[model samples]
Target: MTIRESKRLWMACGVGLLWFLLLLWPMLGIKPDGLEFATTFKVFGYVAVAAVFIMFFYQVKEAGYLDSVGKPVKGAAGALAAAYEKAPTWLLLGIVMAGAIVYPLVTERYAHDVAISVLIYVCLGLGLNVVVGLAGLLDLGYIAFYGVGAYTYAILSINYGLSFWLCLPIAAFIAAIAGCIIGYPTLRMRGDYLAIVTLGFGEIVRLVLNNWMSLTNGPNGILSIPRPELFGYEFRSLSSMYYVILGLAVVTILAVYRLNYSRVGRAWEAIREDETAAELMGVNTFLLKLLAYAMGATFAGFAGAFFAARMKFVGPESFTFLESAMVLAMVILGGMGSIPGVILGVLALVALPEVFREFELYRMLVFGGAMTLMMLIRPAGIWPAKRVGRRSEEAE
Candidate 1:
């Protein structure tokens, strides 16, 4: 690296470290009885030392001092990619399915719970992927559909004593209707305006759930929701529930995969790239956008129905804006428009918090920091989707 660039790098690192120290001290050093610096400095020292080491190694790598080690690593990565491309699709899918089938048998109940959560989010992520990733619709209130589905199942199961299997499609249908309702008014909006309308819609749903005493029980939440039953057996165990969600997730994956390569998927992509051009080319931007919302919300409804069945409850708090953001984050972080990427993102975000549960108060702190680092290091995502063609500058 050039001397000027080296100096600038170190300067930026120094400033960042100072800023981190300032933020860290106020949080850790301020106590109830008195202010203290010992604990704060101790933690800061560890962070500062680690940062310095990382920067030093980075600088060395940039200077080509690690070329001998880097070259082999890069070659190995390329070979692995080539091998992956050559592998049969069924073989890869079989391996994944086998692992999933065995997961509950190998892990404890808590692990099963986390896995269930991951699978549920996977469904949500893929559903949202349809609108945000493919159609370029920025939906901030997608969780409202989720809530709709959950409440649909909850109400049906409790009031009418409907079976979980029967309520599933019913929930999906209701959520799809909700999606169209929300998507209709936002048809003319785009970017920030669309986001604001969706956000409002989501909050409105939450408020209704919170205040609708007759239907939602005013946040007391519905209870005694029956578990899903197949034939004569009820899914009352965690392992059984895991399998249920696993099947649902697989269905979601298949449906989304088909849509991704279909004519509708191409239309969504065209609309995403340039809505005006898509319209000029005879694409029905209006109906397709509404379809995107409905399709996306359908999977969410499936997930929500399952969620209500598993939890035996549905409440306004569960469908908060934060939940919507997290689902969106999973999509963006994993690689929008990629099914596998969404699943990986779901696993990372859902499992990481469980893994760091021992950290107690610092759990979210570590999670936020990791997300920021991931964004900075790979802004496109962990595994970005492959587009049809490259831009002119990129091709050049």
Candidate 2:
């Protein structure tokens, strides 16, 4: 057989072997009914999935022909005009519809936890991208706004009798306000100093939540947060929440894309490329910086609100620095400036782990190692920013 066929056959066999081993876990010396057994099986599953992903990554890297894209992408567009020209909206619409229909089937029968988490992360990552990726702002405590959103919805709706739908806008508004508070002082700060400030800011929020018993109920957090419903039906199942999250994610993606190509987006880009030059050219750099921060925070808030509504839980611990790091990693690791790349990065890093179920701890370690290695190899990310095609090529 040819090498390609041989590879496929080997992969198929490997998968079969994995399933056999998964089934045999209980039959081994481990006790089936004990907590230890469950934990051990979970770890086994994680190691298996991690091994598979690493193997896949290595195989693809060795191939060296295809770029390490987060996911499939349309051809590169050099400018806003190019993106508009190449996008072909109708086809994109068709694909979105197909996805919406498929999302329910996949999440309901197969699994829901990981997919939901990824969808939430997708929204959060896209939100953070506005600041970190497009606007060149470092927001280490982006999760603070997420907490704000979640707590806003949870507190208002649960305590004072508000609706989940009403809380969405309110949560966003609160997050925007918080963003302005952070952005005003830090506009002049950039790079390491700014990074440290944001990190500190995130910690401050978490501490406040822990200490401010009246404001955040200390460690208890807001529980029994109401879920969104369509018409008379509450989003009772995980599948129900999946659709809601998916809709929000789509909206977030579209909004980010629009901003990326709009006048403000250009202004942000100008600032990112050279802050002094942008100011020299009358970009209103300060206001734009604040706007970027507010908008980015607002989106995170929306995601956090949705998360609160679905899970019916909101705790300070939920919006920790590690969460911030993971979200930032998703944005940077995905490809800072590329939407498709970001999506792919989220899927691989966020979605894959939830589905696999076997390798949570070790998988994280492996991914951390892989990311460090990737920084050395391709710092721009898996899908590097594409330069404009030469006009000389048109003559040919």
TM-score of each: 0.98, 0.76
The segments of candidate 2 whose C-alpha lies over 4 angstroms from its true place after superposition are: 1-89, 106-110, 385-396
User: Which one wins on lDDT?
Assistant: 1
Write the residue-wise lDDT of candidate 1 on 322-346 in tens digits. Answer: 9999999999999888888888899
Worst lDDT run of 10 residues, candidate 1, spans 358-367
Q: All models: lDDT?
A: 0.93, 0.81
Error of 1 at 237 (Å): 1.3
Error of 1 at 86 (Å): 0.7
Clashing pairs in 1: none
Local error of candidate 1 at residue 333 (angstroms): 0.9
RMSD of 2: 8.7
Backbone clashes, each candidate:
0, 4
